[model samples]
Target: MDFCIVDWGAISSIAAALIASFTAIYIYFQWRNQKGAEVIANEAKQNIQDILEIIKIVSLIRQKSSALERSRNFIDFNRLYESVVRSSLYIDDCVEIKDFKKAIDEFFNCCLKFKEFESLYRDYAQDSKFIAHVDSEINLIQIRGFNIVNTLIPYSIYQKKFKFRKK
Candidate 1:
């Protein structure tokens, strides 16, 4: 009787192949997961940039409001109104910022009423009641805008003089 010997070499080769295949699959999945993370990080960065841009627009509107308060005129009010309309584009995706937009709309409406008042009375634009109303509305818009911006950005950034404080 002749005894046949099993080929250990062939068995070892097959085991090695299986291990290599599993390693390749594991590496491929890891790469895919890494790519997905990179995409999400990029999107978050873009969102932050958009929020920053919107904050800048709000700041511009606030500055214009101050200028309008200093020199009340149809031209400055018209410019500020146009700026408020332009800012709507930035606040489209931001639901929290929508309140600020509503405030801007209210401020714009007040400007229109002031314009009408100026046209009707000419001298009543500087009346205490009208001036007070406009100032209050502007102040409200500024406070709301500052709060919204502070919520979006980090405290470090705000602490570095990027914050808007009521004077």
Candidate 2:
């Protein structure tokens, strides 16, 4: 009688190698996905913080009750402009965001109007009538800042963007 032999030891070793390879691939992909999620979360958090800071700066600028305080607004305005420009990159400027960028551009115009009006209001501090007229213009510009910040800081818009991207 003749007997045939099977290489059980080699077969088991090959099976072990295949299992390890598959496990390594699975772990790598899972790690990559988790890292991607961490990055997205950090971006969203940064954006929200920036939006709130912008709104707070606008409020501080608006709350100036004296010509001297408002006159010094250029410093705060500069900070606001820099913050907005820097945050724009982090603001999720994807095509799906629609005219969110247009609103951001509108801030430049709003800040310019505030700066000009405040300067006028401050320059004619000695004249009563000119101060009155300057006050009207400055008040209007402040209101514009208020409106713009309202639109920019809404959580619903950011939430929608975040949720859409999370998918």
RMSD of each: 11.1, 6.2
TM-score of 2: 0.51
**Which candidate ranks first by TM-score, i.e. highest?**
2
C-alpha lDDT of residue 63 in model 1: 42
Cα-based TM-score, every candidate: 0.41, 0.51
Residue-level lDDT of model 1, residues 98-139, one tens digit each, is 244555455445445544533433454447786566556555
Regions of model 1 farther than 4 Å from truth? 1-4, 65-167
Q: Which 10 consecutive residues of model 2 have the lowest summed lDDT?
A: 158-167
Clashing pairs in 1: none
Q: Clash number for every model?
A: 0, 0
